[model samples]
Target: MTIKAVVFDFGGVLIDWSPEYVYRQLIPDEAERRWFLTHVCAMDWVVRQDGGQPIAEGTAELIAKFPEHEVLIRAFYERWQEMIGGVLDEGAATVEKLDAAGVPLFGLTNWSAETFPYAWETFPILRRFKDIVVSGRVKLVKPDPAIFHEMASRIEPHLPGIEPHEIVFIDDNRKNADAAAALGWHGVHHTSAAATEARLRELGLPV
Candidate 1:
């Protein structure tokens, strides 16, 4: 089927988000920083925050588990904005191009509901999306079919019975791309703006 809308993943794909960016400022020691992130402020713990867990509650839980790293653990949420390096210009330009071409744009991101305000406030380009399904808001993260289905379902209210197959989903992770592909959506495992633009052109988009 022909593509109708373009769905984008936020972190790593559209914007540069990494816990290390925040931790590097707090913990100056390289090896110690890696260990703290790996063991204390692990991705597993942060993903829970992405799935709607309160940052305060999550930080408390981590601090309880590792009392010695209290300051560092709190910094994870206290300085969450520092984690995002800023929007990736190359990738964001594709989004802008698609928007200018009158293509429907949407975002499907795994981000903390508590911290998303920082991004929402920081980046003006993000406002261009017609709609966005944040995993934190819905308590559902991708690679799960539920999140994909939820996003697809939401689109119907706007587009009136648009099928999942009509959306082109772009993500940096292969598994997330594969999951959307399984649902009959066109999935682009994005590496760079040039490659994504090429794919869009192949799909006959005006971009």
Candidate 2:
């Protein structure tokens, strides 16, 4: 079937979100790096931020847990900005191609509300999307069908004639992409902009 829309994941796909980018900058000492990753990274406190916990509250909770490393904890919370650079120009160009070809575009990401505005500011191309579903604002994360269902619901009203399978969801996380595929949407595990463009081309969409 011809794809009607393409959904993108922001972090690993459009923007550079390498944790090491921030860790190397903040924790210069190898010992401190290992310690921070072991105690803090493993906790996955960012999940709370994505799960609708306020940034201030989440940062405070993390600080309380690691009272001795308050500065490190704060740095970790603010490190998202450091990790984010401008969108991949090639990816932005591909999105433009897809849009010009009449394929609807949307963003489905597990991003915090606190960071979304910054992303919008950094990537002006994002405004071209018809819709965006951010986990922090919705209070639901991906791989949980609720978020997918919410996205489907929002697009369904706009595309009453389209089938669920017509929406191609592109995400870097295999689990989330698999979950979306299982729910009857077309899923693409994004490896690279080139690879994704190839897949879209296969679907008869110009990318």
**Model 1, clash count?**
0
Report the C-alpha lDDT of model 2 over 128-204, residue by residue, as the tens digit. 78899999999999889999988887787668877877988988889989999999988889888899889888877
Q: Model 1 compared with the native: what TM-score?
A: 0.94
Every model: Cα RMSD to truth: 1.4, 1.8
TM-score, cand. 2: 0.92
Worst 10 residues of 1 by lDDT: 156-165
> Please, what are the lDDT tens digits per residue for candidate 1 over residues 124-182?
98999988899999999888999998899777777887887789999999889999999
**Alpha-carbon TM-score of each model against the true structure:** 0.94, 0.92
